[model samples]
Target: MTESSLFKRTAAELAEAVAAGEVSAVEVTGAHLDRIAAVDDAETGVHAFLHVNREQALAAAGEVDAKRAAGEQLGPLAGVPLALKDVITTADMPTTAGSKILEGWQPPYDATITRRMREAGIIILGKTNMDEFAMGSSTENSAFGPTRNPWDLDRIPGGSGGGSSAALASFQAPLAIGTDTGGSIRQPAAVTGTVGVKPTYGGVSRYGLIACASSLDQAGPCARTVLDAALLHSVIGGYDPLDATSIQQPVPDVVAAARRGADGDLSGMRIGVVKELGGEGYQAGVERRFGEAVEVLGKLGAEVVEVSCPHFDYALPAYYLILPSEVSSNLARFDAMRYGLRVGDDGSRSAEEVMNATRGAGFGAEAKRRIILGTYALSSGYYDAYYGQAQKVRTLVTRDFEAAFEQVDVLVSPTTPTTAFPIGEKVDDPLAMYKNDLCTIPSNLAGNASASFPCGLAEEDGMPVGLHVMAPVLADDRLYRIGAALEQALVSEWGGPLLDKVPELETA
Candidate 1:
């Protein structure tokens, strides 16, 4: 295949071809690297990566080729090029969460997913950028600087996982890793016109991922197609003894479900349209496109019904409270004396002075904002009123999802209220910006499987609109099945990925 053809194929398609001996792993890796060289330096500079493992990737691809020659057993991802969000630890590369504090710090070990991806023989592309500590909905909060949107360079690529989404959308890489606490993974995918799946919280092990909002943070897949996402998800999901919350059982066969969906079916699924998320704050085109997605599922012989989730109204405030509190606790590990950036005089400085200088210099404004908010919420008399009450609200939100799931197999909504906005649009107004995640935070709090795939393009802005699909916790494979089915249906009508038809940008 030509290098551009290699860039354009979905991760699964590339993997399948490689596994079938139609192509060698080295050629594919080379093509991807060439594509990254061609565009990653330019105007739609996705900045998807914080570090590029050029030598490591080439070495891995070479080994894959040698293994096949030796007639060794091979995994499906044997030749695939993929990225790890910098938050996921990798012994060979730095694992900064887009923060200056940990800028050049490499972990001594790999995360469960990072290890598994390596075992599956996927080539390591690099570490992608993200919001500092995965805190914001836009990568503008990243210490490495914002990842620009590929569709329109002036706009955002989405946050927390913006770099991952932008990487795949721009064909810099066919697949990448992302951690979603609130809407980080899916929202970025929605805006970038890619597929991102936030597997049921704890579906993927969190032992080595940097903590964000601990209860809500989930490392998931971002790719060009639903089946590609399924391929990566299936490989990464399952138990890890090191992660306390990991489910003890093997991950259900998510890949098989995607294969089943690709067979052109969705017979008896009960897909619920959440009544509360459809109107008001949502943009006209978002709701319009979601309505069309419902229609697609209906045509595929699935029952789609509107279900009410009244408790969702309280999800946003509760999330901000809970996330900050966890962050305050998790970030304490970054104190200057222990690890990361250390500031102040080595011998003369007091412990408190060192910490203050380190944190003040290392942390971005958003990180500081959340840490301050968290510290205050957890302090003295205010603890009972803020953090405690937010926990109660979290419990209520979980119950809300349970109630809705009882009536429907999977819940659906427009992924975000709108398409990608200008890069700096929401960064200045913290509260107004956090509201961007209003539709997304509830599912994260509930510890469920959520997926965002392009439903259609927006009429007003000609940007991609995403439809959110969710399933109960641990029923993750079902999400892949339904998501793949819907993806196939939508593609049948719209032809191919929304970005394919849009004009490509001139490089810087």
Candidate 2:
């Protein structure tokens, strides 16, 4: 392949080519670096990355090339370059979590996934932008700036992990790591014409991953194709002793499942259409595209039925309460006395004063809003009325999932209520922005495996719409199976990946 075209290859293909000696690891890594320079930093750039580890990436690529030359066995994703969300700690790079408070803070050690990727020979392109403390639905809350959708520069890429998704959409990187706390990973993929998975809670380790909501946050793969995502997923997923919540099970054979799904057969699979997740608030085009995808699944021989999870109606409110409650506790560690940003520390003020001043200046509005809301919810008199009640509601949601899964192998819905909305269209309206995750939060609340796959473009605006799939915990492979089946069907219809329809970015 020509150097310029290397950026267009999927991670799996690139890895195979490198392993077969068709292209050196350095060449593949360089092609991606060159692509980032040309599109990410251009005048009309996607602004997806917060930092680009060019030198480190090439050095890692060189190491992979040396290993290949020595006839050593390499991991399946060896030599593939990946964009990482800023929330994952890297010893060599700053992990700001898109917040000014932690700006320039270099982690003392790498995140578990970061170390795993390095051991597997995956080159780290750099840290991508995100919502401040992973708090908002739109990337607009990022302290640096919002990442633009590659499909439509004026529109928003789905929240918190938008930078990672945008990078994939623009071909800046073939694979990425994104954390999903209330659809941060899947929702971004939904908007960017990409694939994103939220592995079952505890499916992937949380060690060194900066917390959004400890119970809700999960790190997962992002890619342009479901098979590519499954390949990447196998690399960074598994048990980790360092994370107290890590599952003690082995990672599922998602790659094999994806390959099986690529044959486009879902015979004997029972799929459920989430009755509560669509309709009233959904966009006409989004619902239309989602319905079409469901029909395609039926054609693939999957038994389709409408299933209702009634408690889902309360998920949005319950999630907000629960997430903020955890955010309040997790963010407390960032006091001025600690390692992050400090303020009012000239020896004349008390530690409390310094912490107050530091947080006042350092935290963005959304973070502060959540902190306050959470504090209030957990306060003396209101705990039962808010936080405790939300927990009960959460239990109900999980039970709903249990009941639904009893009758179906997996459930499906429109990933979001609508396609990508224009940037700034809902930033000022927090409720509007929060609603973007409406269709995705139930899976997180229930700690089930979920994913977003590019179904097709919405007819009204020609923007990509995602089909959300949810499976029981530890059944993450099921997500890949369904995503791959739909991806194959959709790619066949579109004559290529949906991202092929994206307008080319201006070269630097």
Candidate 3:
């Protein structure tokens, strides 16, 4: 098959072809490397990847080809190439987390998730761009520069995990991995018109993910289709001894759920419409599309009901307080005495001086801002008034989910209040940027299985609109079932995936 044709195939299709000897893994890997070269350039590129592990990727793909040639059995996504989010450690690749602090630092060991990918024979194409320390909503906070939306070059791809989502939307990779500490995965998916899942907090191992908020962060899959995500999810999800929070249980049958949903039946399924998630403050086009999706679900045999989660209004404030407190504590380990970037350490400088200088120069503006806010919140004198209160609010948010789920199988909302905004539009506005995660944060705070699926395009800008679905923790299969059913219904209406309608960028 031609390289172009190979790039267009889904991860499952590529794996099936390789297993059947219809194509070599090397050819598929090479096609993606070529595509990355075309669009991931430094000057006029999408800036999706911070580093590309070209040599290692080809070597891994070749190994898969050899195994297939030897008649050895392989996993479902064995030969599919994936772009990993920078936050995950890889012993062979530079994992900077999009910050100058750890720039060019390669970990000596692979993260559990990275090891799992290799064992499954999935090729790691490279580490994609992200917000520095996963702090900001827009990727413009990256020390390496931002990842542009493939659909609209001037606009932002969703933040923190933008690089991963953009790589899929641009057809640079069949699959990608992302971490959602808040809306890092889902928001980017919403804007990029791709699929992203934030599995239950402990559903996937957090052993190798760079910590943003220990309780809130979870690594999950990003892909072009629900089935592809389900396939990747099965490969990555499971218990890990290294992660204290890891759940010791079998992953839900997500692949089976995706397949079942493709038949488009939601009979007896109850979907809750979050009352606070839509209406005023949401974009006119976004609300219009969400309203239509609710109607469509009704037509598909799903009983749709509006449910109120009042404490959700406090999710934003509570998240900011809790996340920064954790950030301040977690980032304290990056002292100049250890690895990563060190500045002004010419021997003449004292250890304190060098440490202060290094951090001053290493962290970006947003990182510094959060660090300070977190430090202050965590300080002894003021801890109770701020950090302590936020934790209580966190409990309320989780309780809200428990009550809502008691009444419905899953909850639905607009993934993002608006479509992709301009790259620099909200960079200077921290409040505005934080507001972007409004619909997505409650799920993170509650530690549930949540996903964003492309619903339709906004009428105003013709950009993609995503329907956010949240299921009870450990009930991840519900999200896929609903997403697959909704996706099939929408695809039939739109004639194809939304990414197919995205305009190609002009080559420099």
- Candidate 2 local lDDT, 43-88, one digit each (tens): 3689999999999999999999999999999999999999999999
Residues 1-508, candidate 3: write the lDDT tens digits. Answer: 8887999789999999999999999999999999999887766778899999999999999999999989999999998999999999999999999999999998988999999999999999999999999987779999999899998888999988999999999889999999999999999999999999999989999988999999899999999999999999999999999999999999999999999999999999999999999877899999999899888888889999999999999999999999999998999888978799999989799999999999999999999999999999989989999999999999999999999999999999999999999989999899999999999999999999999999888999988888999999999999999989988998899888778898886554
The lDDT of model 2 is 0.93
- Each model's TM-score? 0.98, 0.99, 0.99
What are the clashing pairs of model 2?
none
lDDT of each: 0.87, 0.93, 0.93
Candidate 1 lDDT, 110-139, residue by residue in tens:
998889999999999898888898888888
CA shift of 332, model 2, Å:
0.6
| Model 1: residues with Cα > 4 Å off, grouped in runs | 42-44
Residue 330 in candidate 3, Cα distance off native in Å: 0.5
